[model samples]
Target: MLDAGLPVRAFFTDRRGGHSAAPYDTLNVALHVDDDPDAVAHNRVVVSEAAGALVTFLEADHGITVARIDEPTPRPPKADVLLTTTPGIALAAIAADCVPLLLNDPQTGAVAAVHSGREGLYRGVVDSAIAAMLDLRPSGAGAAGIRAAIGPAICGACYEVPENLRARVGRRHPVAVASTSWGTPSLDIPRAIETRLTELGVGPVLRHRHCTFEDTRWFSHRRDARTGRHAGVIVCEGPVGVSVPAPEDAAT
Candidate 1:
């Protein structure tokens, strides 16, 4: 678990400590990756244990859609962003190479877990999530009180892409445009996200420098095609007494 630098309980999961087999190995939290259903459930239970609350794992649609979680649910709606203000309800965003982003508003106690890929980042998922978080605050609340954490993902030095694709994403997010070590066009997704977070007025943005493509600790789809996925999880604390529910079936 990587510390998210927030007051609440928040961290990023790696490929360790669970019930999955090879490729998925252990601690794989994604259900859509053809891993064993029973194993995935067991892994989710492990994650929930770490979170100390019932987790609402989100399904990423690679878009800017945001789903609000008012209570703990086994299956949440398909969306790239999951937002919740309810305490004791943990939210998780699973990813292999895509950025697993976490946000928390200390003032409002609202938190969000985001799956930000190239498509979702270009489509303004960060902005969408920030807007939803601000909605839970006072009428004039700004993002200054919001804290963001960027988890492990494919770094710019390894994320080689076609020139045209780089140009397209660069048009909107110029910082995303980068050159790989071998002088090929690439996109620094985490760097671009950090830039966007600052541009949006969020503070204390904590970023994990671990690259999934380079580090074997985290899962990377680009590094291993049939690999498992990790998650960025955050818990919304409330009064003690609410019980956590069981994990659900594999998500489609």
Candidate 2:
């Protein structure tokens, strides 16, 4: 939806559409996973072309770092989430088994992309992103207009966690804890994210129903340790001063 007039254009890419091979298969977008740099670059181009914007990549390390799109220079800031008020620039975060969150303020046209796995979740990426968005667009006027979408991830049924992890997740999102097939505890990352968004007063929360682990169509690092990464991308719609045509028109 990048070309829409809404404040943000956002989408989560699956593993089915790129050029890669073997353990990484195809469409692996992560440069950190030991995938060939050429393949990764090609994959990134595919994502950008699909999103219709030049997506700025962020190095996510399970920490919170806020970035503005208008900045001329890039610094070494590692964060699991990135936010921007500037249009025409898209922000992207990477994930494999983790949860990717896309947020938008339709009124102000600001957006953010977040990568939150168990560690990032523990670090409060959701809370941090909400705080950053609110700070950029203060007052309930802009905050209340925010919309969020929680993308594909490892489902709780397939996401077995150790007792320590389970306990930590339970502390923040008790409802996400569930008994696993082996009778161990697991955490629903998406559920935790949804709860956090509700708590932060996000207007609408849409969830993708696919489980990366169970669905071979998507990449799952937990299921296959050598798998490539997928990206969640969001950008402000269109080039400066140029209106994007309606979807119906584009289809013609």
Candidate 3:
């Protein structure tokens, strides 16, 4: 877990250590997948227990929907990102090959979990999330204090695209257009996101080095079309928060 001085703890879970079978394998956190519902629930329970809090799960639909910490419980909203300031309210987003972006305002104790895939990128979902966080921040202090982390996903070397899709993504962030090992044109989704973050002046961006497509440990939607989903979770923590457990701690 990365501590951003916010009133929460956040971490991205790769595809490992859960109770699902076959293509879903072990650690599939997505309940929407055809995987056993009981297994998904149990996986969430395990994550919540590890965090020492009750986790509030969301069904992500790759749109811009913001949920407040104190709202009447309704069906999961179709949002690519979820934000909250309430302590212990875990804001989560699911992805297989798409990028999961986590943001935390060290001063305001507000956090956001964003699912930015090709469509979400095209729609400027990440920019919207940053703007929303700025709006939620306390007076005077702006988005400068916000720290962000972009977790594992398919890298440009493994992400191929046609010229049209390339042009579309490049229109937003030109750095995405580059060559790959296969001698084909590819889009570096992470680079595009980093460019956007730079444009937004978001502080201290952490990019994970792992690629889901290359690493068998993670669930990749493109690599396994019918595979289960992995989750990136963020939960508000108490003033005296507990330490985040290491990967080995939860390997069992």
TM-score, candidate number 3: 0.87
TM-score of each: 0.93, 0.86, 0.87
For each of the candidates, give the backbone clash count: 1, 1, 0
Candidate closest to the true structure, highest lDDT: 1
Write down the lDDT that model 1 would get: 0.88
Greater-TM-score candidate between 1 and 2 = 1
C-alpha lDDT values of all predictions: 0.88, 0.74, 0.73
lDDT of 1 by residue, 57-155 (tens): 999999999999998888899999998878888999999889999988877778899999999999999999998887876698567757788999999
Model 3 lDDT per residue over 1-252, tens place: 223223357787766778999899887888777999999888877777765666666666666666554432324567777777777677667788898888877555677788888888878888888987888655654566466778778999998888788888888778888767798878888878877886786765667757889987788988889998777777754223222323332210
Top candidate (TM-score): 1
**Tens-digit lDDT track of model 2 for 145-185:** 56777878898888998888899878877877876666888
Error of 3 at 164 (Å): 0.9
TM-score of 1: 0.93
Q: Best to worst by lDDT, what's the order?
A: 1, 2, 3
RMSD values, in order shown = 7.5, 5.5, 5.7
